[model samples]
Target: MVWTVMPDFEGYDEACSQFIWDLPASYNPAVDFLRKHENSDRVALEQAYPDGRREQYTFRELDELSDRLAVGLADLGVEAGDRVAVVVPQKPQNPITHLANWKLGAVSVPLTVLFGTDALRYRLDDAGVAVAVIDPTVRDDIDAVRDDCPALEHVIEIETNAPAGDVHAFEDVLTAPEHTDIEPYESTPDTDTAILYTSGSTGPPKGVRHSHALWLGRAAAAYNFFDQGLGPEATVWTPADWAWGAALGGTLFATWHHGGTIVGYPASGFEADEAFDLLAEFDVTRSFMPATALRLLMEVEDPTAAYDLAIETFAVGGESLTPEIVDWIAETFDSVTINEFYGQTELNLVVANNSNWFDTRPGSMGKPLPGYDLAILDPDAADRGVAERLPTGELGEIALRPHDRSVFFDEYWHMPEKTAAKEVEGWFVTGDLARQDDDGYVWFKSRKDDVIITSGYRVGPMEVESAILEHPDVVQAGVIGVPDDTRGEIIKAYVEAAEDAPAHETLREAIQSVVREHLAEYEYPREIEFADALPQTTSGKIRRKALQEWDAQGSVDEESP
Candidate 1:
């Protein structure tokens, strides 16, 4: 599919020069995705499962399905402003649940299928979910915590065999009368649409609430980062879970807002060969991938050599992209450059390396997207109630002005104190460290908790990890600071060697030598440990916290003398 009206941008300067921040008083994402493409029978979602089953749905079909589900849910006593938890795998039903909730002016709380019983119970109880739409596969997990969730009243099962006692079958819900006379709820821009929980790396996952306007605000991202205009014919895909904001907001909502198609596939785990196959099979035009997934994909022998890929734009996030991975992609794919974006579940897509607007910088996180005011402020200023912007090239905490209501989140659900702690004066502290160059490009450093201070020098693990990745034998790398009596904190590198590489003293010296050449001698790792695998989060981020704990427990092998 080709766009009816192509996107126009002179360059990065012109694209960021102006933006439209006005949102309609009353807006619904479901209405926008369907009404804009109502006249055309374009495919909205195409699902491919590992079991060799494929499903395709048009915009009209999804509209009807969500409409029926909304009416059916309303029949089950769900009302406006109520909390409804949606836990499903990557399928058409996932987005359907979101649209259904929006249609009723109800809040949709997305939960990843990876969550265990305890994690599920915490979020369900915290959000006070009134009704839950869950995939049948995890029914038992929910059932284990059902008695604990006092606010949970009903359970609706989707993609399952039959309805058990008290469990409402999704098939039955969809069987609602075709012409059920249920009027769509009229929700203002301020009406709540979703409560997305963070990955809970530091502590318990916080429920980040977003209004309908916040969902609609992603349009600027669709334009600047995606290089898409109205009625774009782009087919978007991402390996990230639908529950995460990157997939929900970045891929699904962004693509639909531009009237583009979304491609989805079911895989037990990520396989580079299968991913390449899906790209070629569906002829995906645009895609988003986490850096971890990209690293794994690059490990495959000649990833792009075998497939006839139609992907034109590839955007990566969730972690930093090293120069090694960027160069690998450049050499493998024809006319394809890696576009990196920076955002969190709380704030969708704030900063990006937009290839359409500017050249793709390997390590730079790019400038802020239109409609956002971003800066590097002194971290100590958080207690003073006024953010002090650091000079160019000075590393500091990244902060955003909270006045951008169209793009910023409303609050953390049921946690007023925590929400209040996130703001200082009028700035919302992102808690991530970064520095901006004079050219207006922002370079991501590390999370505030992940930054290391050793021997009177500050170091971001990303730079060290990037340097280590340049070695031929390294498949993946994780860097952390260990307790040191002399240096306060010393750099320790955990290297995951390639399948054929051996763990030896000579290899460790070679890895350290690369860092010494690329960075200062103080930044190089003093100790290197070859490991079979590194700890990672379900969302594909390296779990530095876990690595830190392992170091505390002395789980890492001692460095060779």
Candidate 2:
């Protein structure tokens, strides 16, 4: 698929001459996009499974299936604002359920398979989910707690042969009704569309409710700014789960909203070679993956040998992109851009590397995306994290004044107190610290809570992590601060060494030496611990909170942090 790259933000409409944004009053992203390109030659999805089973669908067919699924759901008593919980891997059925919920004006809450019974039950009860679509493999845990979930009325198993008690086969629902009798419900765009939950370090996960306007508005801005190169004919791959804000808002919704195609490689397993082969076979134009997968790909002496598909935009998030990974992509695939953006589940891409801007700044999460107002506030100021807003070329906590509140995450679902805690007046405190250069580019410093304060000096973990990654023996690293009597908190390093390197005290000292030489003495890690592998969430991010907990519990007894 050929792409017409926009020369500037002003030329976005010209590059995609047929670009149109006409959202209904109750603008569900699925229904809105399906209505526009129901008859167009737009490919809605292309799935290639591990066993070689492949399937493709046009926009019109996807719309029809969603309609049928909606009719079936309505028959099951799902009403407007009702919650439909889906726990499935990356499959076409996932998208089907998403649109089906939108068609009925209900909320589609996608739960990742990584969560166990406890997490699942919390979400099921918290969101007041009535209908649940669980994959047969992971449905056992859900069934165990099904009795306790009072709001849960129906449990539909995806591909299970055994039909236990109240559980119904997923295929039965799809085939029950081809009826187009389902009427479109009138929904206010500002009403709650989804309830996304996010996990915390201390307690259970918190649900974040997002409205239809927030979903579409974030999609529109991201569609216009970050992905100007994608055409309506392009196919994109996002390794992230749809549960993630970046994937759901940035890739999934934005792609369909802009009338583009979404391609999938729904492999439940992680195989670097097989993943590379699939990339080559599909000729995927745009793909979003985490840095760890990209790092593994770079380990291949010549990445082009396994997969030589034309990658337009190689984007990554959920973790900071190291200089080595960024430099490798630029040196190997010069045409493909390796860009990083800053955001959380609460908001979409508030800052990103614009497509037309060829300038790539390693360690920097680019400037604010177009149509966003950002300010870096001093930490000592009265705003708790953001003291006073800093001017251009200053360092402070990165805060944003969203142009439209409706386009942001509605609020922490049922956690009004926590939502009120995050919102300082009107500006959303991102909990991140950054410094802007003279060119208006924002450089990530650290998370406000994650920052280490020693001897009244502030230290950013990313800078130290990047420095440690440069060491020849180190493969991955997660840095944090532990209670220190001398200093307020001392920097500690958790290192994942190269496969051949010995996990010994000597290596720990050597790692410390490297950090000390590369960065400031205070910035160097005072304590170091080696690990076989770092604990990460399903999204491939090192869970620093879990590591910190392990330190407190003394469970990781191998070495001291």
Candidate 3:
């Protein structure tokens, strides 16, 4: 019943010195995250609806429900290693479906409900999913893609009053006579657990294969970064979709792993007011926030005066935190500990900030977690798996030597070449580029290809975008490299301004000036373009590739040379 990193840590250095990898001999998410707590009276989940309603469930209740669902899935012909797609929002059904899949030793394919027919078909067909458990909202999308995904055998919809289709209802399936007295599948520590797809920022989304071992690595990071430990009284929440590994593993499972409570808002996206309300209403102490969510929260004024919040820990990532945004968090949440963590969806929780153990640095991702061996390496040598370490303060690809394979992903599902390309010598190369300070903190620069080369100088687009975000009128910004006969490539910026700010030459010059002052003068964008909105991914990433394409086609509105 005891957990490591509980109740007290002398300091960050000691935690690292004494910390050891606690990999379990046998692991299954259904057991480690849920079943172990089935006898306890602790609350497991409290999900909220936009229509002013909240539902709470205990670990014991979920254990029994998942057992029934597991039995139903088996009846539907699902077996060990078969993929079961989960396409639902942040309701109890989302976690229940995942638990059922893992209980049956089946691999879960979690797709966001935001996906359309093409997106759904690609993942369903690729993962060879046999059964899909979905929300009524996305049932039509699943129906449209069923023909293309021949492996999809049946669609099970969550109980809703809406007209039922040919598919079976979730509640009806759980009530079957076979639901009782079924034995759960046994699993090893290395048993393949889930296949999570990437954000597809660069190209098509690749399925990332994970095992039961992934939880230990992610939980360890959460333990330290989430203010040393989360106890039974702790209530955790995040604006991130449960489909993302960061939210599911880093937030949901991590909370239940410690017998704590988790709150969920099953909305499609983030709203600043709702974020504060959820935190206040649930008395949420632990929170995992993406940078976009923080940015959205920043738009509001004096939130502490508006909401009765009891937040203690604010763990943030998913993108770079502009200097301004960082300052706003420190000032606004004066009572909360703000820890800025860093990692890609492919391999997360490796590097993070724990302010309770050390001095929190501004604009820096904290030191590597205890079990991880991380370093900055030559990006060019990464594809060949060459372990070449870059000097301190030098920007290079962040790489890790998987001393423990459980903490990292197994491989890109069915993409060995892509997986192999991720390593440098024996180190796993993170596609992200950063510089490590002498004190061992990492400062993220940008993605590998996102570095813009202009007139014999290299520029990180994030630095430019961050600077532009500091402007009073700027709402969103995207930066890219454009081909130029003279400079090889020139830095260009696309900006979305506020209603009060006009798309004029003066506004462009003012934005350019901010960047020049914040970073090197050469790093400022040479060309500025104004638009009503900049292209962004569903996760709030500024799609610079789309910006480049638009620029190439000369379709940018109000472009200024």
How would you encode candidate 1's per-residue C-alpha lDDT over 1-561 as one tens digit per residue?
A: 112233466766665565445666667788877666645478988899898899998888888888889988888889998999989878888899888888888999988888789989999999999999998777999999999999999999987768777788887776465555556788777788888888877667889988876665555565556655334567888888888787887778778777888888756678888888898899888888777678778867876667888888778888787787788878888887678888877776788887777777778898887767787889878646677889999989998763357567889988898888787777788889989998888988888888889999999998898888888788778899998999999999888888877556988999889999999999999988777778766676767777777777777533310
Candidate achieving higher lDDT, 1 or 2: 1
TM-score of each: 0.94, 0.91, 0.95
Off by over 4 Å in 3: 1-8, 161-165, 176-178, 502-504, 556-561
Q: Cα lDDT of model 2 overall? A: 0.74
**RMSD to the native, candidate 2?**
3.8
| Per-residue C-alpha lDDT of model 2 across residues 21-89, encoded as one tens digit per residue | 344454556666666754455677888788888888887877777888888888899999899998887
Give one clash count per candidate, in the order shown: 1, 2, 4
In candidate 2, residue 180 scores what lDDT? 61
Give the per-residue lDDT of model 3 (tens digit) for 440-481: 898888889888888898888887888888897887889999
For all candidates in order, the CA lDDT equals: 0.80, 0.74, 0.81
The CA lDDT at 347 in model 2 is 71
The numbered model that scores best in TM-score is: 3
Least accurate stretch of 10 residues (summed lDDT) in model 2?
Answer: 1-10
